[model samples]
Target: MPPRSPAEDRAAADSDTAAAGREQTRQRVIEAAIGLLEREGRDAVTTRAVAVAAGVQAPAIYRLFGDKNGLLEAVAEYGFAAFLAAKHVDPDPQDPVEDLKAGWDLAVEFGLANPALYTLMYSEPGNATSAAFTAGMEILMGRIRRLAAGGWLRVDEQLAATLIHATARGAVLTWLSLPEDERNPALLTALRTAMVTAVTNQQPAVRDAGPAGAARALRAALPEQTTLSSAEQQLLREWLDRLAADG
Candidate 1:
């Protein structure tokens, strides 16, 4: 590559500084909006209010986020990023089922702790496409894959992921809907256990459980196998996926 001239280097440095400043402003605005949402509910998160809280002009919000809706989208993404940061991932847990349970509990705990942020992040279906949300899902899928690799998964990986996510969301929403005096910790425990039972087998399904367990285990481990060619692995994966889904 050709070396940049001094003028070009100065221009690039200026661009970098400008980009960093913009990101800092965005973070400030997002944090301010989140504070308003948590303290005064969604209606208080207006562009004017956020700008005031962020110590910026109202037009700065428009320049940074386009509009209130766009600002909300950014807030939801920030919430997901916060949730993802709190998550503890165990790549090789001694007990995959326990790991799954812990993961679900952590998600529910986060929702319970940040009811306003959680509701805002989850209430809109479009936020599911956020990068942070996608990253969190990837973590959940990794846990599910671990269960499958251990022959502990009762359902297909995709279905298992859905069940786990749905249960956590339902638990959080249901808990938040109840009066504080009426709220019960048992409800969370019951939902968590039910989700676990719904998605996992008590024993390794690969042995006497069924062929589906074996298929799932094989499918989960397929990518790590060195013996298969790329084409062979692809074909095997298709077959295993079909078998795993059969249950």
Candidate 2:
């Protein structure tokens, strides 16, 4: 074989090494970005800092995630996917209302379990599993439709779903804002009960015709003698009333 040129040989080796370096840098950038987001919240996620943390040049971030929005989108997607994976709830399609209640319980469990990730996925800016959130809204509507079909929902199916989602989100956000000590034991339990009462009419949630309607609906949903005692019911009702009064 003819002797290869030294420059050509060096050039080929450099290109191969550059390709490997690119991938390593990309992964490093992604990891650093996620860590920064987790540790400092969304505002701390800046390109320069991410690059420094990743030990790569700032431009590498652009190459990897395209832009700040792109990086945010990636984080939201991965964050939510991870959240859903970590949540081990099995939705029962056959009994969707029960499954939805179970899912809501699981959501609170997941939120309390991983507060940072949960907040990032929901309240955190640009930190959303867009696909999952959208799908969840659809599922909520479908469930509302089911309730309507069964004569459980007495209000607009669509509007009812939106309000319930808002209430659940607001409840969690307010709880997160409270001092840990004040968060109180059984808070989620109370909140869940309130939410169920606010939305359910027949042992499951249903649409409400008015503000007090949800609780009354909830009362009607349960058999005359129900699992919740007067005290527990009163507390949940109070919680629901407070939220309702504020709005």
Candidate 3:
């Protein structure tokens, strides 16, 4: 390869500087929006409001996020990233059921602490496509996989994930809807326990002769098995998934 000319080097440096500046501005705006959402609720998070809070012109918000909806999406993505950071992942827990409980509690706590931001993050179905949201889901799925591997999962892995999400979201929304005098900590505890019972077995189901438990264990382990060809493993996974879902 030929060495770069002085002009080319300068152009590249300028591009890098501009990109860094853009990202810094994006961060500033997102933080401002988050502050507004948490303090004054979602209705207070207008583009004009965020731009002023971020110390940038209103046009900058439009340039970076397109519109109010786009800006809210970025704020929701930030909320997901914050929640994901708070999660404590234990890849190989001594008790997957306890691990599940801890994870669910962390999620509910996050939502309760940031009610407005949490509502904005989850109220729109489209927000689920954000990279941060997807990353959070991947972490949840990993936890579910561990449960399946230990024969603790009682439902399909997908169903387990759905139940976990549904319960936590419901808990947060319900708590937020109630008067301060009516809000019960027992409701949260009951929901968490119910979620655990709905999705997991008290004992490792692998000890049983049932196909569901065996299939779940095998499916969890399949990715590590090299005895089968790629095609064979894929086919086996489909069959095992079907059996696992029967639970």
Candidate 4:
């Protein structure tokens, strides 16, 4: 390949600088939208208001995010990124079940800390398809997978995920809705304990030595099962993973 000329190199550098500037402007807009949403509720996050808050023209918001809904989605994504940044996930923990509880607590705390942002991200149903929401789901699934690997799960992986999300969402929204004097810490504790009971087996499959245990054991040994075709093994592994987690 021919080396780039000085003019070409300068053009590339200028393009890079412009791209970085655009991204920085986008971040400023997102931060302004978030502040508006949290301070004055969702209805106050108009493009005009955001432009004034961000010290940018209204057209710039449209150019960067496409529309008002797009801007709100960006704000939601920013909230998710901020929350995830504060969280610490252990890939390998001594006790997967405790790890699960800690993760749940962290999620609930995030929601409580940023009620407006959490409502914007989660109050609606369609957000499941958003990139940020999907990233969060992937993290939740990893925790569920760890439970499965440890033979502590008591429900199908998908169902377990749903249960965990439902419980946490309910706890956060319900707590937020309560009057200050009526808010009880027991509500959170009860929900967390209930989630644990509902999703995890009392005796881990590793210790129970039963069908669930056998299913879990088989799932763990799946990589060594060379008799099955690759596709067949994958299918079997999925079944075993479900069975191992099933109550």
Per-model TM against the reference: 0.94, 0.60, 0.94, 0.91
* Candidate 4 residue 216 C-alpha distance from true site, Å: 4.4
Question: By summed lDDT, which 10 consecutive residues of candidate 4 come out lowest?
Answer: 216-225
Estimate, for each residue in 36-98, the C-alpha lDDT of model 2 and write its tens digit.
877887788899988888887788789888998777676666656555565544333566466
Residue range 62-172, candidate 4, lDDT tens digits: 999999999988887788788778778788888988999999999999999999999998866666677767877888888887787677877777878999999999999
**Which digits, one per residue and each the tens of the lDDT, describe model 3 over residues 68-159?**
99898888989999998998888788888888899999999999999999999999999999898998899899999999888888888888
Q: Against the correct fold, how does model 2 do in TM-score? A: 0.60
What is the overall TM-score of model 4 with all chains considered together? 0.91
Clashing pairs in 3: none
C-alpha RMSD values across all candidates = 1.7, 13.3, 1.5, 2.2
Worst 10 residues of 1 by lDDT: 202-211
Please report the TM-score between candidate 1 and the true structure: 0.94
**Candidate 1 or 3, higher lDDT?**
1
Residue lDDT tens for model 1, 1-247 = 9999999999999999999999999999999999999999999999999999999999999999999999999999999999999999888999999898899999999999999999999999999999999999999999998898989999988889999999999999999999999899999999999998999998999887588999999898887889989999999988988887777
